[model samples]
Structure formats: C-alpha cells, structure tokens
Target: MILCVRFLLDARGEALLPDLLGLLGELTPVVEAAPPDTALADVRGALRYFGRDAEQLAALVRVRALALHGVDCVIGAGPNPMLARMAAREAEPGVTRVVPGSADGIREFLDRKPVVALEGVGRSMARTLCTYGLDSVDRVAAAPLGTLQRILGAKAGREVYDKARGVDRGTVVRNAAARSIAAERPFSRDELDPSRHRRALLSLTEELGVRMRGSGQVCRSLALTVRYADRTGHTTLTRSRTLREPTAHSASLTEVAYAMYEALGLQRARVRAFALRAEGLGPAEQAARQLTFDPADDKARRLEAAADKARARFGERVVVPGALAA
Candidate 1:
C-alpha cells in the first residue's frame, strides 16, 4: 500500500515552510507543498530504501525538520492524503500519528470523528448535517447515500460519504515541487472595492508569472489567500485550483487568479491583503505545452518572451503591464 505523509507545522509569524520542505526532500523526492505551512509526501517508494515503516519515516522527517530549521511539525501517516490529513489533525504538535492500513483500522479511526472534521465539510454543511441528526462521523457513515444526497448536493454528498469510509482516490504527483513560490500585497487601508481586489490579484499574478518563467519553473496549481477585516476581527480566506496544464505564462496565471478571486464573491467585504502562490512546480522545460491553433496566443507568448529577455538584461522595471504602470 502507498503511504502519504501530512506534515503540519505552526507557521505563524515565520517563513520556514521552504526550509521544512527542503528537509522532507532528504527523505523523498515526491512532495506536494501545501502552504502557508503544510506539505504532503508520498513515501511508498522511500520506505523500501529507508528500511522503515511509514511511521518511522514520518518521525525521521519531523526530527530532521526540527533539527535543521528549529521547527516542530506534526506528521500523520496513512494510505492516502485524506487519511493522513485527518490523522494529523487528531495528533498533537511535534508528534507522529500513523493510521493502520487495514479496513478495520481505518473504519475505527474515522468513526469517532465529528461530522465537521470530514474534509470539505464546511461550517454551513456541518450545520445542515447536524440539523438532520447527522452530527458524528459514525452517524454520517451509517446514513444512506440517498439521504446524504438529499441533505447535501449530489457531488458533495458522494464525496463526504466516501470520505467517512476513509476512501480517497488521490495520488501524490511524482514531480510535485518541494517548494512553492508566494507573493502577498497588503492594502493601505481596509478597502472595500472589487476593482481594487482584482487589481491586486492582477499584480500578484504578473509578479508570480515573471518569477516562475525566470526560474525556468512552471506550476501545476495556484492558491489565493484573501485577508479581510470585519467588526469582530480580521480573518483570511484561502482557496486553490489545479490547472489542466502547467504554465508560467502571465495570461494563464492571471486568468486563474481572477477566477479564484471572483469565486470568493466578496462584494462588500473589507480587504486587508491579497496573497497568491504557485505550487507543485517543476522545470519549465519538462512541462508539456498543449498545441494551440490561436495565432493571438502564439503572438502573445512571443511578446512575453521578448519582454522577459529585456527584463533580464535591464531590470523588472523595464517591462510593466499598463494596469500596473505608475
């Protein structure tokens, strides 16, 4: 069975995520970075070479992360990403938790959890489930699929039903990057304009695209973090989307960032900051580009190449999008 590791670190007021991920690379090359301070490592292949079970390998990674970066992390080991993440949440910081890979073991581990603890079950969904007397994992598990589908939408219902049984179809990508590139922009005031938010996202995408292209890297996914302020306090909303094709092109990055921002639907929320991250990176040369018949797309890419060359020779200031020009 394949083993997935969820490395959860306390990353408040610090930027040690890259260092911790670098340490994981010492154990396995297959790592998917989940920021601001979480990562998933597939150690199925490494277990044979390291001569250790998933638990031992997870412990080793935690020790190395602590020794090298003075960062203590909670590691959860299981047959897949969903189980590993669930186990990690149940574990104390600076400890390792491994779920046995047997049917009985997985069921026992998942049955006692709260319905809210199931992945992708948001606060609203949990409230709805609880209203219908489906409050615990065991309760949800025992409920009929048609019942769940009636409570939640068909897609979400099926997803939660499978998760309650500890089944996840996700696999760790072999070329998943060990480090992700991130950029954040803070507003001067608690702004409440959608146009301003879109502009901020555009700026971040441009910056990330340029940096990625310059480093000869392409990202498989993009994450957006929106920090906002309300009457009670400040909070941050984050979301991520995987791309169909890996790219470092500004147009592609901007499109996805804009879509994510729109999905948040923050029409009247006070904004504090905007952060965008590129994850699951790999060398640009290794990424396969889909052939396109659009001449406009080809022309835009050619122009981008020329602009990158100019920026390399002069500086980032040499090439600036009109929207960003001062």
Candidate 2:
C-alpha cells in the first residue's frame, strides 16, 4: 500500500527533515521527501516482507520516528498518495491513520469534510462553492464535473472534482531537490513604519541570498508575505522575466524582493512580521545569466561576492546592508 507520512516536526530548527528521512530509511527504501517537513513512503513491499499489514506497518514507522529521531509524525496510510496525504493531515501528530482502500472506506472518510479540505480547493474556490450552497465534500462529489470545471476554471475545477471523489493519480516522486530559499521574521513588538518593515524584508532577502549561494541555488520567482498587526496576512507573487543566474548575489535577490514589496503598496501599514520566499530555484549552472554591459550590475555582483566571503570568514551580521541596519 502507498503511504504518505507527514512529520510536523518542531518548527524551531531545520533538523526535522534530515532526522525524519533517516528514521524512514530504516523502514523502507521507497521514501520520497516532501518539503517543509513531510515524507511519503511506499510500504507495500515492506509490509509483506516484514509480515505486517498496512496499519501495523504505519504504526511501526511512527514509533521508530519518535523513538529514534525525537521527532513527532502523523502517518496516513492508504492505497494511493492523495488519500494518504489527506488522511495524515486530518490525524493528530504522533498518530497513524489508515484509510482502507475500499469504496465504503473512502466515502466514510470524505463524506463530512468541507469541500475546501480536498487538496485542490483553495479558500477562494471553497468560498465560491459555499456561495453556491455546496459546502461539503459530499455535495461537491455529487456535483457534475462539468459544472465544477466551469465554476473553478477548467483545470482547477477538474482537479477539485477528482479530489472530491477521492480520485488522485499522483505518484510519490522521491528525493526532489530543494527548490527555494525562504526566511521569516516575527517581530517582538508589532510596528507601524513601512520603512522599518522594508528594512526587515531587505535583511531577510540578503540572508536568503547568502544561504542560496552557499547551497548553489538561484531563484526565478519572488513571493512576499506580510503579517499585519491584526493577524491577517497577504501574499504577493511575482516572477523575474529572465532567469536569475545562479550566484548567491544579495543584490539580485534584493532587487526582485524589493520590487515585489513596492508593488504591494502597503503604505504606512501596521505589519507584525514579514517573510520572503524565493521560488523556482535551480542549480547555478542551469540558470542563464544575462550578459549585461551595465557596469552597476557587475559592480554590485562583485561587492556581493566580497560581502559573502567576509560573512563566511567571520559570522552572520558581519556585513549588514545599510538599509537593514536602519
């Protein structure tokens, strides 16, 4: 049986994924990494080899992760990846939930969940469905696929319809390379200055660039999220027209990061914290850097390289950007 084991590790440190994967490797060879602390393992072969049923095998995996790795996990076992992921999300940490691979079992599990709980339905889609008086997954499953497609757009609508019916065709692909560098800062006290907020964002982007360069990844998309004092958050996404070349140049990440923030127009907004996530990452070799006759770009790249070297030799905060210091 296919199983999607989700580990909601302690968010304090980055040791979660490594430890979880090491523990899972003890149980099976067919393990796939899910980002931000989650994993999927195919235990069908291991189940028979170890003489344990699906549920029993799931329990063992959870126990091992906790006992050996000091990490808490939520295990979801099913016949397919989609069902397993959903089941795991619904389960509490340190428990194993098994969705029997049967029609009755699927129906029983999905019948009462909100339509939005299905994988493809986002908040907007869920709101739209609720407005149309279909608030539950069961109701969505009973709706015609054509109707769902028309309402949610052809692709999203079709995907949601399939998910509502517990139909997922995705296979767990293992060892996917890391594709982004993200950093989030929570303020000790919520502040109202847009300039200070911008400074914090700049600092985070610089940190991200440093880490990205160290790991040999370059990003193509910039995503910014601002958490307000009211606890509501907004996210803005923008992509670079040309692929950013694979140097961990802070200037490059900072330019795109600041541009995305400026586009948000958060004038004098009271923000509690800010996050910058650089997505669509690839190896530096894979990115095509534009050959620029612009001297400033070349100079900035050189300065960034020097700063990175200084930080590596000394420590973080050795080379703080002027704006961030303010």
Candidate 3:
C-alpha cells in the first residue's frame, strides 16, 4: 500500500521535512520525499513487520510525527501513488483518509469528485471538459476515449482517462531528496504586498541558482512553502513540482516558484515567511540541456553564467536581478 503524507509545517519548520522523511524511513525504506513538506511511503512490506494495516500504520506515523517533532500531518492511503496523493488532498490535518484498494471501492470514492479535483487538470481544460458535461470523475470516466482524445490531445486524454478510473501505474521511487539545498526569506514583519512577496521569491531563486551552480549540481524538482502570519496557530501551504529537465537556472527556478505561490491562491493573506528547496541533485555534467531557438533564451543562459561568475568574485548583492534591486 502507498501512504501519502503531508506535514503541516510553517515556513521556519520546513527545515524539518528531512527529519520527517527519516521518521517515515523507520517504518519503510521506500519513502519518497516530495518536499517542502510531503512524502510517499510504500508500506506494503512494513505491514507485516509492524503488525498493522496501511491505515493503522498511517495513524502510527501521524502520532509519531507529533510526538517526536510536534508536527501534525494528514495521510492518504491507497493502492498507488496517484490515488494516495488525491486522497491526501481530501484529508484534514491530523487525520488519515483512505481510498480502499478495490476496484469497486476506488470507483465509488472517485466517481462523484469534481473533474477539476484531479491533479494536472488545468483551469482551461476544466472549463473545456465542463462544456461537454464531463464535470465529474464518473462522467469523464464514462466518456469514450476517442471523445476525450478529440477534446484534449491523445496523450493527455489517455492519461486523464486512466486517472479518472483510479488506474495509476506509478511506483514509489526511492530517490534521495535529502540531497537538497534550501533557501528561506523571512519578512522583517508580516507583509501583505504581492509585489514584495514576488521580489523575495526572485531573490531566493537567485540565491538557489548561484549555490547550485557553484556546487556544480542541477536539481530535477523544486518546492515552495508559504507561512501565514497567524500567531495563534502556524499555517503553511507547500507545493512541489518536477521540472521537465534538470537545471540550476535562476529564471527557470523563479518561474516555478512563482507558479507555486500563485497556485496556493492566498490573496492578501498575512505572509510571514517563504521557503524554497531544490531537490534531486545530480552532477551538472550529467544533465541534459534542451536546445532553444530563441535568442533571448540563449542570451539569458549566457547572462546567467556571467552573473554567477560575478557573484563568485564579488558578492551576491553585486549580481542581483533588476527586479530584485531596490
């Protein structure tokens, strides 16, 4: 069984993600880290060792996280990664939501869900699907494959059709996300200005790019965590995305971080801090670069290299982007 765990951590507490991954490691070796506050654990093997089912193990893991780190988490249990991830979103903090590992059970759980609730269904596609009356998972699943393909290209349609039916073939990849570098920017005070938040994100990506380039590494994914300024209780929203390819480019990193921040949909919420993590590091020499035809894209890469050298000789402040300049 797959257990998707999302740690409810504040910006400052994102540094604890690795330790939380370790806590899961004690239960199973197939724990996949999806930082800045999530992980997937294939606990099928650990069930017999611990003498508990997936749901029981999830509860134990939650209690252990709170007892050991004072971190509350929600867990989603399913037969595969996709189902588990979807289940996690439906779960509240400090609880476990399960998608039963049976064909009938999976269908019953997913059928009534909104089509937009499926991961990777963009806003545009959701509208398009809804136009055709495929507003729910069951409706999408019931639609003919050829019809969906005509609406949303062949590849995406096939993928969506399979997902709506709770058919996920992905496995828990045992890559070490512990080999990551993180950068955090805390507001001098809780700030509400969107422009300032973006500036901080840009500054952070700049730092991450310089650090990764200096270390001769490239990251395959990035994570962004936002902390709210509520003193009574710390509230954090985190989201991570895998890049199409490995890169240490500052602009690319900045773009992904901005998208993540926007996706959180926190309009005018009191923001206290932001945390970014670059994960799945590999030697820069081993990474492939996608060729681009645009001169601007080429120039940006050239300028990035030059900026890295300037920062190495001078200082980070010496090579700040125009947007980051006060």
lDDT of 1 by residue, 82-184 (tens): 8888887767766677888998999889887889998899999999999999999999999999999988989999998988888898877755554578888
Give one digit per residue, the lDDT tens place, for model 2 in 189-218. Answer: 767777777778778878888888877788
Give residue 44's error in model 1 in angstroms. 3.3
CA lDDT of each prediction against the hidden true structure: 0.83, 0.76, 0.89
Looking at candidate 3, what is the lDDT of residue 196? 88
Task: Return whichever of 1 and 2 wins on lDDT.
Answer: 1
Prediction RMSDs, each to the true structure: 6.3, 5.5, 5.8
> For candidate 3, lDDT tens digit of each residue in 1-326?
89999999964566798799999999999988886678999999998998999889998899998999889999999999999999999999766899999999999989889998887898899999999999999999999999999999999999889989999878999965446888999988888999989998898898889989999999999989898876677698889999989999988998999988888887587888888899888899999999889999899999999988888889878878888776
State the TM-score for model 1.
0.62
* Model 2 residue 40 CA deviation in Å: 1.6
For lDDT, the strongest prediction is 3
Candidate 1 regions with alpha-carbon error over 4 angstroms: 1-19, 149-156, 177-181, 185-205, 209-274, 278-309, 312-315, 321-326
At residue 273, what lDDT does model 1 achieve?
A: 91
The reply for model 3, stretches above 4 Å from the true place, is 176-182, 190-203, 214-326
